[model samples]
Target: MNENLTNAQNIANIVAQEVELMSALVQLLKKEEEVLVDNTPDKLETIVLEKNTLLTQIIALEKNRNSSLSQSGLSPDAEGMNLLFSQLSTSSDVQNNWERLLNLSSAAKENNRTNGILINRHMVRNQTTLNILQQNDQTASVYGADGQSRVNSNSGRGIIAG
Candidate 1:
């Protein structure tokens, strides 16, 4: 029973850290959305770096929590978490923290999805602009590779005074 309590405490601590990191991730995602909307590439780059770091930390905490669960002969899934909570004396606090972590994780996922849509929209707009520029270049060029003037027979403009 003592061992079980220790394992439960360890798992709870890991979950608390995960929740904290996940909350930071949610806030970062909000900043990312703002940066995307404002079209600030510089700020976006920095935010991406920060997000990566936070995600790394969160992932590590998750792994630690799962490992602790496994060591306790648990399955490291919702079922295992439920079993652990049910046996714990402080189940309410631990269960509430786990729920909060899940909610924050969901928020981060949605924000990331929104940012992906914004990035895709920007990519399409950029590609369209590039295509227009390429088409104009092909039609507007008056000189050939040998530095000779090339005339377009389909232009319908003829020399009047030459």
Candidate 2:
């Protein structure tokens, strides 16, 4: 029973850490959205790096928590968490932390989706601008390969050669 209690406590601590990291991740996602909207590429790059590092830490914690759960003969899912909570003398803290983690995860997911939409919009706009520039370049045709001014017949303007 002591071993079970110890395992429960360890899981609780891991969950708490996960909750904290997830909260940070959620905040970072919010910052990412702002950076995207403001069109700050440099700040967005830094934020992406930070977000990746934070996500790595969260994944490590989750792996550790899952390993602990497995060693305690529990599945690494909600059922397993509930089982661990059942074994604990005071489960409220861990339970509450788990709930908070879930909420933060949902927020992060939504923010990421929004950022994706923003990125797609930017890409489409840039592509449209590039296409317009390319079309104009083809139609204008101001210079020839021999460095001579090439008059575009379609433009209805020719050199006076005065």
Candidate 3:
């Protein structure tokens, strides 16, 4: 009925949708973890693509929510959101939804971090295997500004003579 109420509802809906997306992201991350544990790198590409798409959707929805908040003369920050909620008649429900959304976001972030660690571990293992196969045992090598290999001081002796 009231424009402010309508704006508040829109914001709520956006947040709820974001929470849904984040939930999906968490699921995807869990699936990725399973795939990683199984050493199924092939499945990861598809999962990554799905994650990127969900991320894009979440970003777009956030932009829309910000626009809605701005239109309602809100700052689009935490304080502004609190102020907006205080002004809304549905404050209690909206606040609850916001809290849930925040929790979901935090959980998603943690899951994503775990997935990243898993990925890094997989990469390191693969690199180590490759190095062994190549018979190159160097502490580590760095890429130079020109994208050339910069040998580490500890490169005591490469399996292959340079």
- Assess every candidate by TM-score: 0.83, 0.83, 0.79
Instruction: Report the C-alpha lDDT of model 1 over 51-131, residue by residue, as the tens digit.
Output: 889988988888888888888889888889999987887799899999999899899999999999999999998867755
Q: Model 2 over residues 24-122: C-alpha lDDT tens digits?
A: 999999998888899886888789899999999999999999988998989998899988878777899999999898899999999999999999999
Model 1: what TM-score?
0.83
Candidate 2, which ten residues in sequence have the lowest lDDT sum? 138-147
The lDDT of model 3 is 0.82
The true-structure Cα RMSD of candidate 3 reads: 8.1
- When sorted by lDDT, best at the front, the candidate numbers are 2, 1, 3
Off by over 4 Å in 2: 136-162
**lDDT, candidate 1, at 161:** 100
The digit string of per-residue lDDT tens for model 3 on 1-162 reads: 388778888998898898889889888988988998899889988999999999999999989888889888898777778988888875887788778878888888898888889989988997787665545733353544354666556768657876
Candidate 3 C-alpha error for residue 95, in Å: 1.3
Distance from true location, Cα of 5 in model 2, Å: 1.4
- Pick the lDDT winner: 2
